[model samples]
Target: MNIAGDDMAMGGMHDEGANKNKSFGERLVSWLGRVHTMVIHFPIAMFIGAFGVELFGLWRQNRDYQRAAHVMLVVGALGAIVAAFLGWFAGGFYLWDRNPILMTHRWLGTSIAIFGIGLAYLATTYRRAPDRSRTVYWGLLGLMTLAISVQGFLGGTFMHGGLNHLAF
Candidate 1:
C-alpha cells in the first residue's frame, strides 16, 4: 500500500496531488485509514455504555438490561475489530518520526480490540444463563475499561502533544 508514500501524503494533508499517482487500491486503503478517525468513537462509547447497562441490570435484576448489554458488547467488539485495523493503516500513514509513544499506543490499541472481543464472547456465552456470576462479569468489564482508558490516553498524547499530559 506504499505506507511510506502514505506518510508523505499525510504529512501534507492538503496535497491533492500527493494521491494522484497512487492506484485505486492504494487510494482505497488511504480512504479506509481516514475512516479510522471517525469510526473509533463508536466502540468507545458502546463499551462504556455496555458496562454501565450490565451494572445497572445486576443491581436491579433486570433481564432487559442484560440483553441490551449483551447486544452492545458483541456489536462494540466487532466495530472495535474494524477500527483496530483501520487504526493500524492510519498509523502507517502517520509520520511518527521514530516516536516511541506511537509504538506504545499501537500495541495498547490492539490490546483493547482483543480485550473487547474477549469481553463480548464472555457476555454472549453467559447472556442466557441465570447462574452467571456478576463479580466475574464486572471484573472483566473493569479491566477492559482500564485498557481502553490507557489506549485513549496514548492516542490523545499523539494527537495533542505531551506524552505525560495526564500528569496534571
Candidate 2:
C-alpha cells in the first residue's frame, strides 16, 4: 500500500489516465463519487414528477394527487441524500486547489438534500390537510421546483464550463 500514491491520487485525479496508479481506496472513493451523476437522475425525475402530480391534483381537486406527490417526495428526498454523499466524495477530488464553482456546487447540493428532506416531511405531514391549506403546500412545492432548477444549472456549470464559456 503506497500511502503517498494514495494521497497524491486523491488530490486531483481528473482523468482515467491520471487514475492509472491510484490506490484501491482512492479509486473506490472516486468511483463512488462518479455514481453521483448517474444517481442524480432519480431525484430529478422524482421531484419533477411530484410537482407535476401536485399541480394536476390541485387542478382536478383530487386527493389522490396529494398521495402520489407524497410518495414521490419521500423517494426523491432519499435519493437526493444518497446522491449528495456521493457528490461530496467526488467533490473532494477537486479540492486540492480552490475551485469556486465546485464549492458552490457542493454547498448547493448539500442544501438541496437538506431541503428535500424537509419538503418530504412537510408533504407527508400535510398530505391529509384540508383544502384550505393547499396554498401553503403548493408554495413549498414551488420552492423545491425552483431550487432544483438552480441546482441543475450549478451542476451543469460545474460539470461543463460556465455559462459564459458557451459559444452561443
The clash count for each model shown is 0, 0
Q: Any runs in candidate 2 off by more than 4 Å, and if so which?
A: 1-17, 93-97, 165-168
Which tens-of-lDDT digit does each residue in 15-41 have in candidate 2? 677578888987898788777778999
Q: Against the correct fold, how does model 1 do in TM-score?
A: 0.81
Global lDDT for candidate 2? 0.77
RMSD of 1: 3.9
Lowest summed lDDT across 10 adjacent residues in model 2 is found at 1-10
**Candidate 2 positional error at 112, Å:** 1.0
lDDT over C-alpha atoms for residue 95 of model 2: 39
Model 1 spans with C-alpha error above 4 angstroms: 1-14, 93-97, 164-168
The stretch of ten residues in a row with the least summed lDDT in candidate 1 is 1-10
Query: Which residue pairs show collisions in model 1?
Result: none
Candidate 2 clash figure, as a count: 0
Candidate 1 overall Cα lDDT vs. reference?
0.76
